[model samples]
Target: MFAALAAVAIFTGFVDAIAGGGGLVMMPALLATGMPPHFAFGTNKLQSVFGTTISCANYTRGGLVDWKGNWPLAVLVFVASASGALVVQQVSTRILAYIIPVILLMMVAYLIFSPRMNDEDAHERLSRVGYTPVAGGIGFYDGFFGPGTGQFFTTSLVALRGNGLIRAVGNTKLLNATTNWAAVLVFALSGKMIWLLGLSMAAGAMLGGYLGSRFAMKHGARVVRPLMIVASLGLTGKLVWDWFVS
Candidate 1:
């Protein structure tokens, strides 16, 4: 079972590194281990931390991440995510279920149809000050639901901040790492994680993350944009299904 979980983690890490729907893969796989849903969520977070950290490191070393400009956003993401987790129990997620899919579909349409959307950076629509709120809001969304946080971050950077695809992906990894670790800490404190299972999966995730990052680095926007589009569509489909089914 552990070996099988690790294998799934490898693939999840790879898809997650390139796009951002890793949870779409990892969560269902974890549930198949017969773990309780809460424990699965916690364990998934533990393994995801490893994968995201590796991807972030790879992006940083490749000079794709804007560390100096993005550190503040990372910090904000952590805090905002933590706060969102704390407040989640008090709020109904039905609103998000209805709204997020629409937004995600809009993002998909924009990415698909926008002629100017390319690998190259363009003029910025939002300044650093404007981006702070955006980062904080997305971080909160990650903590609260977290299906397509990576896609959201990448899209926002590319469309709003005028970043190239490669750079947007790098920054997305960093912010994703921050939010992931923040949620992991909360889950760890609640004693929800199965450390043995999570660590085993992490081993696989680390390797997958490294290889995926390398591929993204080599392929640039050609790979990332299409994956982003797929991920966004997938997320939208899932959200719509859940909303209708419920």
Candidate 2:
């Protein structure tokens, strides 16, 4: 079971590095291990930290990440994500089940059809000061529901903040790592993680994240944009299915 979970984590890490719907793969796989939903979420977060951290490091080392400019947003994401994780322990996510699919579908449509979409950075629509709250809000969503977080972050940066696709992806990885680690800390305090399983999966995620980040860096938007669109559609389908089944 551990080996199988690790295998899935590898694939999830690869897809997640480019697109952001990695949880769509990881969560169901964890649940199949016969863990409860809360345990699955917690363990998934533990493993995801490895993958996101590797991807963020790759992006940072490659000079794609603007650490100095983005550090404040990263801090806000950590705080907001931890708060959301704590709140989620006592609340139902049923409402998000209905809402997130619509939002994801909209993202897919925007990615596919937006004429302004391009690989290069454009004129900024929102300054860093204006985008901070947006980042924090998305961080909260990640902690509470967490499906297409990478897509949301990437899209907001590109469409709103005028970042190029590659830079947007780099920043997304950093922010994701922030929220993931923060949520993991909260889950750890609550004793919700399966340590052995998470560690097993982390090994695979680390390798996959390295390879995937390298691919994204080399190929840029030619690869990332299509993957983002595909990931968005996939997430939308999964959420709609879950809504129907529930």
Compute the lDDT of residue 71 as modeled in candidate 1: 91
What C-alpha lDDT do the candidate models reach, one value each?
0.87, 0.91
**Model 2 worst lDDT run, 10 consecutive residues:** 110-119
Model 2 gets an lDDT of 0.91
Top TM-score hit: 2
The digit string of per-residue lDDT tens for model 2 on 202-242 reads 99898889889999999988889899998888888888888
Candidate 1 ranges with C-alpha deviation above 4 Å? 89-94, 244-246
Task: Name the TM-score of candidate 2.
Answer: 0.98
Residue 110 in candidate 1 has what lDDT?
82
Tens-digit lDDT track of model 1 for 163-242:
98888899899999999999888778878889999999999998888888989999988888898888888878877887
TM, every model: 0.94, 0.98
- Candidate 2 residue pairs in backbone clash: none
Q: Candidate 1's C-alpha lDDT?
A: 0.87
